[model samples]
Target chain A: MSGWVKIAGLGPGNEALVTPEVTAALAEATDVVGYIPYVARVAERPGLTLHASDNRVEIDRSQHALRMAAEGKRVVVVSSGDPGVFAMAAAVFEALENGPDTWREIPVEVLPGITAMLAAAARAGAPLGHDFCAINLSDNLKPWAVIEKRLRLVAQADFAMAFYNPRSKSRPEGFVKTLEILRQECEPERLILFARAVSRPDEAIRIATLAEATPDMADMQTVVIVGSSLTRVIDRPIGPIVYTPRSTPE
Target chain B: MSGWVKIAGLGPGNEALVTPEVTAALAEATDVVGYIPYVARVAERPGLTLHASDNRVEIDRSQHALRMAAEGKRVVVVSSGDPGVFAMAAAVFEALENGPDTWREIPVEVLPGITAMLAAAARAGAPLGHDFCAINLSDNLKPWAVIEKRLRLVAQADFAMAFYNPRSKSRPEGFVKTLEILRQECEPERLILFARAVSRPDEAIRIATLAEATPDMADMQTVVIVGSSLTRVIDRPIGPIVYTPRSTPE
Candidate 1:
């Protein structure tokens, strides 16, 4: 059997959001590998062997999947959102780049999924309807200074912003400092959305101004979207619909 | 029957990338409305009417969809990719904001899909694995100055950029100016990916450095991705894989 590895996105905690391509890949795989929760999302089938590892072991998981594919086992690496965005696809490519030459010969494909930011943005009208930037606020992989610099620059550019991994138990101060920087660079009326567990049963979406936003509102599950200066909120009997207008006047 | 509007993304030229949620919305839709090519993608069925409009008639199409929905028709407003990003969701919301007060009472939902940038990035590699910004390079809705300012600021901030509507027959000069601004702010050897007709049968993906790139390489069908300074490429017998590393040195 010619074995291959497919890196697939499961979407943001919603089965309906998972593409048929990803579901087909899962059905064909002999081995599934990813973080514990992501792997748990895949069902247990007779022919499939599940390998669920802890967080921060992305490289190790990638190597394992690649090795399995080399040994003629069809491997599927699962990610919570799109694999190309801050997920397993990069780690798999990194593994292939540094690992044995034989690994490169193993065919790998990235099946795109509906990412968390998009899911969150959809749930909250279209706060990211115009030009936007997505930044990973967790300072674990990159320096905190880099995040701060990008935040200030994006604010200056008047781009709506999406933040991933906003606040964690260990690094709660990152989001605190993020709010502080936004307050310094943007107006007090700037709209910010806190969407937690988006697309899941317990999904909570809160739209608040910069003055009303606090750090504790965001957790690891939350994706925080900050609107540009021109983003507007239309009050309705149903709910307030927040969207950035398509046109920008000269 | 009560009326509703569902804004859906069809994914970048591939049926497999469309989510079950979007597929369900289409199945339940009494009318499908969108730009010509996008509306043509929907299969004709009994009781299902597809409203194909010209490229620049987003507001007209949106108002039509809303009116139909208000008349107790289930309407699906389709965009080629995720509707919230440089697409029809904002336009629909804009229409609703300015239209009759009764329009606010209609149920509306945004179903996310595999956006063009994510699909393009997946095709190339994970060039957008790190922080990235999505910009609509066409100056149709916004002034050239705003696009220019954003190009400069994103380059300075070192965010990988995904350019939607990079060039059109009428606005050929916008992409030309974009290249010039990129040259001014970025290094000569920075990698850029031009993914045209992504995931389609005739899909073409090309990777070139900023120095090697030209204005003619892009068109309306293409999504251009410019790598950050830290992005890397791994060459193989098959093709080159481009990705941005997850870490930055202090």
Candidate 2:
């Protein structure tokens, strides 16, 4: 039997957000591999084996999936959002690059999913409707200097920004510092959104201005979106709808 | 009966890529409004009315949908990709903000989907795996100077960029100028992916570099992705896989 490896995104914690393509891939998989929570999201079928690993073991997980595929096992590696965005697809490709030459022959494909930022953006009107940039705020992979530099430049460009892995138990100061930089660069009335566990039952959305935004508003599960200079807000019965206008006047 | 407006993304031209949430909204929609091609994607059902409008009529289309929803019709305003990302969601909100106070009482929601850039990135490996920016290249709504300024700053920020509406028959010069600007700022070997009609049967992805890229390589159907300095490519039997690694050296 021919074997292949498919890197798929499960989207942001909602079964309804999972694409039909991903569903079809899961049904055809002989083995599923991913972080514990992501792998848990997949059901246990009679013929399917689940390999759930801890976080920060992306390379190891990638190699395991690659090895399984090399041994003629149909494997699916899952990531919470789009696998191509800060997820397993890059790690899988990195594995393929460093692994044995035979691994190159394996049929690998990446199925896209509704990413966290987009999901969060949808839940909170359309703050990201105009030009935007997405930055990973966790300083684990990159230095704090790099993060600070990108934040400053993104603000200078006046792009609405989405921040992933903004604050964690170990990295609380980063978001605080992020707020400081935005305060320095952006206007006090600049809109910021804190969307936590988006599309999940615990989903909570908070819209605030730069002056009112605090670091404590976001955790690891939250995706923070800061609007561009042109973002507007409309008050209604349900809540305020924030969106960046499509046209920028000369 | 309280009426509501749903600005939903249909994903990038694939039935499987459309979310179940979007599918459900379409089924429930008493009136569907969107660009001609996008509206054609919906089936002709007995009770559903499809209001197909031409391009450059976003405000008009949005107002029409809002009007219908306010009059007790379930209206779904569809965009090709995620409605929040350079699509229709912002337009709908802009209309709401300018319309009468009664229109503000309507329940408006933005349903996210797999955006074209993410879909294109998934098809060609994780080229957008790291920090990235999305810019709409159409000068129809924004000034060309703003677009040029953004291109320069974004390149200096060392971000992978996804350019939507890269080219069209009427405005070919913008993409040509964009290519020239990119060539000036980016490295000669910087990777560029022109993904046309992504996720559709006629989908075509061409991998190029700053030196080899041409304006004629893209059309309105294309989404152009320019990788950051760190983006890498891996050759395989199927094709080359391009991705940007997660970590950066201190």
Candidate 3:
């Protein structure tokens, strides 16, 4: 049998949000590799072997997946949300680029899924309906300065912003600094949405203004969406809908 | 029977990319409303009505969907990609905000799907694996100035950039101006990926440097991805893989 590597996204948390392409890839895979929770999402079929590793060991995980594929094993690298977005696709490619030239012959494909920001935005009524930027707030790999620069520039450009890994136990101060930068660049009344465990049963979405947003509102599971200056709130008998208008006036 | 509306994304032209959540919404929908091509993707079934309208009539279509939903019809407002991302979700919200107060009583849910940018990024490798911004290049709804300003700022920020609606028959000059702005803000060797009809039978993906890119390379169906300064290409005997690294060194 020929070896191949498929980097597939499992979507946010809902099985319903996963694409059929990803499902088919999982079904054909002999080995699945991912972070613990993501690997746990895959079923334990008779022909499949699962490799669940801890976070922050992405390179190690990628090398393992590639080695297995090089050994003629059908490997699927699972990622929550789209693998191409701050996920396993890049890591797998990074490993491939730096690894043996012989590994280049293996077939690789990326299967897209419903990313977190899109899932959160949908649940919150499309605050990202207009132009938007997505940033990973964790400074583990990138400098905080880079994150700060992007935040200020994105706010100046008036793009709705989505932040992943906004807050974690190891780096609790990152999101606080993010909020401070947003407050400096945007108005106090600017809208923000904190969507936690999106598309899952424990999903919680909260809409707040810049003035009312606190650092505690975000955790590792949360996706923080900051609206542009033009975002609006439509109050209904059910609840308020937050959306950025499709058009911006001259 | 009560009425409800579900805003669903059909994914980027592939039946396999469509989420089961969206498929379920379409299955239960008594009426499907969207642009001509998107509506054509839905299968014909008895007791189901498909409202296929021309482009640029988003608000009218949205209002029509909402009205039908208010009148006891299970309506699904379909967008080609994720409804919340430059598609029907905001238009429907805008109509709801401006329409009769009674329209607020209708239950609405936005089901996310694989967006064009993600699908394109997947096919081309992970060009959007790092921080990225998505911009609509069409000047129909927004002013040309806003688009120009965003282009400059996004390049200055060094975020991987994705462009939707890059070129249309009516405004071919928009992409020309975009390429010009990108040339001014970025380096000559910066990479750009033009993915057309992504995830479809006729899908085409081309990777070029900013200096080599031309306005004629894009069309309304294309999603243009411009890589950040840190983006790299892994060349193999088969083809090249483009990806933005997960880390940015201080």
lDDT of 3 by residue, A1-250 (tens): 3989999999999999989999999999999999999999998999999999999899999999999999999999999999998889999999999999988999999999889999999988989999999999999999999999999998999999999999999999999999999999999999999999998999999999999999999999999999999999999889989999999998
The TM-scores of all predictions, comma-separated, are 0.99, 0.99, 0.99
Q: What is the TM-score of chain B alone in each candidate?
A: 0.98, 0.98, 0.98
lDDT of each: 0.94, 0.94, 0.94
**Alpha-carbon deviation at B61 in model 1, angstroms:** 0.7
**Candidate 2: stretches off by over 4 Å:** none
- Residue-level lDDT of model 1, residues A151-224, one tens digit each, is 99999999999999999999989999999999999999999999999999999999999999999999999999
lDDT of 3 by residue, B103-178 (tens): 9989999999889999999999999999999999989999999999999998999999999999999998999999
DockQ, all models: 0.87, 0.88, 0.91
Candidate 1, residue A130: CA error in Å? 0.7
Local error of candidate 1 at residue A234 (angstroms): 1.0
In model 3, the runs with Cα more than 4 Å from the true position are: none
TM-score, prediction 3: 0.99
DockQ of 1: 0.87
Off by over 4 Å in 1: none
Q: What share of the true interface contacts does each candidate keep?
A: 0.84, 0.90, 0.91
